[model samples]
Target: MDNFLETQLHPAEICVVCTEPFSLSHQPVALPCKHIFGHECIKKWLKSGQGNSSACPTCRYVVVEKRTPRVDFDTSSIWKALCDQPPERLNSLMMAIWPGLKILWQRHPSGNFSITEILDQAVIPALIKTARRTESPQDRSYDPVLDCYNLVAASWDSLGRPDTATGLAIAFVRLARLMSTASATLPKWLTSTARTNRLLWRANASLGIFELDVSWDFIIEATNLEEEQYFPLLHLYTVLVSQSIAHNSQPTPWPTRRHDIMNLVVERCCTKIGGTFWKGKPSNKFKDVLVAVYEELRRYQLEKGKMSLRGHDGEERVVKGIWALAGWTAKKVEVR
Candidate 1:
């Protein structure tokens, strides 16, 4: 059976799971039914089944191997072969290599270093080259870049490396800029902009960067404020308030301009909530998020002395009004 299978299959045959030609990374493993598949594909297939029972994709024969066979081959030669593929096949080769790249990254001790190498060596260059080569808005090649970025971001977050995450976020902004120059329309630009902002907001908040102005600019460009619903507004308020507290606590004296930005963010939050309240139709979620933001602000003010003395009276008045609008007394909103 092994001889027959070997005679029937060629090294150049494609893997059924990845749909790419078999190479060192995707060596074929034969089943009892004489069906051949990539080793990784069959391993995943068996693992996804119940109690080690699985069927072959081609012949539906019950797979009985206790373990998938492993084959050792020269990765360098395989990579060289892939690199030698024609230009049109580059995307497919990239897709084929992605799983192995991810596996290599996961096995590394330092996720930060692994992700950095992946981005610097493979993902970024491929994305930039692909973007430059393809001018059509309808091209699907760019999807891989977004996917790879998300994967890296998620991995970095899981590894608690917000510094690296922030770096990747900045790289995404650069990628977005490149995409913008490629005649990207509003929707495409906005998609990239929103993704960049989301990553930046989370990373910056974690790192206490607190650059609210830049974050707000990205938010405004990505979303239409008037047409936005609750969650977007909620995200904006949360980022603004959290970063305000962070900025206030920095060693450098808090800038008066930052106080104004905080005030502006608060005012916008109140205006939105007030509109809903006046209509006798306030969203509980919106109010809850606003209340959380207010609570955080109040906590910062009490813990870090006064956040602002320049607008002491005016800030007090605005806080009082916002509390009143929310139907909350001073006691109800005190920091615990």
Candidate 2:
């Protein structure tokens, strides 16, 4: 009953097109606008009216589907050779092969690439094979796998493709899980749990819920304020809050209240920087840091309200929340 109530409180998953439940036969298909519908219904709708005028039934946004041809590459020898080698040799092989892969991807006829195919066919299998060779946790080296995944992620990001990056990050997480199960321990350098969580946070920044929550759990587990990693944690927290606000336009149900979230961040920042941060006279250094955070929060809020920036109550609330977090009054901090 509690589970049922929770489901009721949250948005229910249903196909908008056919007004039916999404199942295997009536699978949910996402349009460019991020709205989803029954696969068959969307296909029929696209075929209806002027075929060229096919648009998302929900948002009426024109849907342009880019199809790519599946290219089969014979990477059997490369995989076998890499699996048999040590981490050093594996790294050398990856460095040599990555350039060629990039060139091939660029020269592909379709231009539209699929990261899933690349990872599944080559990268993941190689990583698993290599992992299986190590008898003990200490003997296993994650550098090669981590380096390869990072390279792929960088390539996707450079190509202005977050979607592909997200897929690659997810693939890395799966690879890490596989390795952990095989070795019974995750590598220190890779920090598999925390790193994967961070990747998940990055990958789903646009529409993260479960990923964001899980990322936070790992982050808190991995670091405390006394460490240097605390700064990165702060940045991650800011990003998550900013993204959540922009995406939802209202208080997120998970966090419950926006002010509560900001207060927690503020408390942590104060503890890390110094006890004097929010006390007596605020130091220039502390103020400078707070200003930077405030500016970023303000920028994201404005971007979210780009359609109509005037008299936006939600934006005002966010602005006020940021100011309160820094122990400053609204009048003391000029938003404009």
Candidate 3:
């Protein structure tokens, strides 16, 4: 009898919620717990926080479910071709990322480069998307060098380690340069990026020649900082060895053990002079140094002919070329 009464509707009885009798305005409605009350009265009870708001007023039964926490990640902007993008895309990246240059050019009245707009809309978004390659979407950490390095490595490797990813390299250089030391030295960000530069240097490095060949093509068109290498890359070994060896604390001298000394001096140079340098042509003082190392002239190695500049020492030093000059039969060119 009691169970039947709980289920039965008593329209003539006053609503427990509002102490009101059912009428046109006091319409009755049933709850999930099989309790009924005047429509507005029950709604006021549930929403008023007078007691257990989630439960039916009469039966104290929960009406709505408690929602659980969720993980929502969006991956739409990451380019699918990141690991295998073509050179043209890398070229575009080279042009797009350097806002500093755009800022410089925009100083002119006619400059139309929308520096902030382009970065907010295009450049930063693209780099952030690329940076996500190494990130947890939930954590979403932002590291400038690590982020730039990832894009650089992906582009260099995808495009067969081409020298054209200069913009990305320069950006990475700016980020990394200040981290290793307290005071600024040589704008030396490139030294910190050995791992990134090695992607390209690996080609000739294994053949017992360690060189990052710089040519006109590298500097041609718009470049990152128009980033001509500070040390003439072709004669870099000469410059590094010639300068550092005179200190003579090195265990073995040059020629007898070139690689060991070469490694030592290069390390010292990277440690000391640093390579954030991205402006000016290389000084040719090393032309006077003995030919302990050499190569260049794939010079027209791109075309059919090689090119050269008269050295301070009067022997022709490759200003632009491709073939590498080296071997046990190395010949010496005298400087005037």
Candidate number achieving the greatest TM-score relative to the actual structure: 3
Candidate 2: list runs displaced more than 4 Å.
1-143, 146-226, 251-300, 303-336
Model 3 weakest lDDT span, ten residues long: 177-186
* Candidate 1 worst ten-residue window by lDDT: 177-186
Each candidate structure's TM-score, on Cα atoms with residue i matched to residue i, is 0.22, 0.22, 0.24
- lDDT of candidate 3 over 130-208, digit per residue (tens): 3434323323343342345455556555766543324344333332221211112212333333322222222112222
Residue 235 of model 3 has an lDDT of 33
Give lDDT per model, in order: 0.41, 0.42, 0.37
Model 2 agreement with the true structure over 1-336: per-residue lDDT tens digits: 998887766452787777889877888877778788888888777755444436787677877442233232112322233345554554443333333334434555332334444454444444444333454332344344444444454665576743343433443433322222211112223322333334222322322221211233333322233333333333433433443333334334434454564454444333322222112433443444454454456465677672322212244344344534544432244442
- Count of clashes in candidate 2: 0
lDDT value, residue 51 of candidate 3: 41
Segments of candidate 3 deviating more than 4 angstroms: 1-95, 98-100, 105-171, 174-323, 326-330, 334-336
RMSD of 1: 19.8
lDDT of 2: 0.42
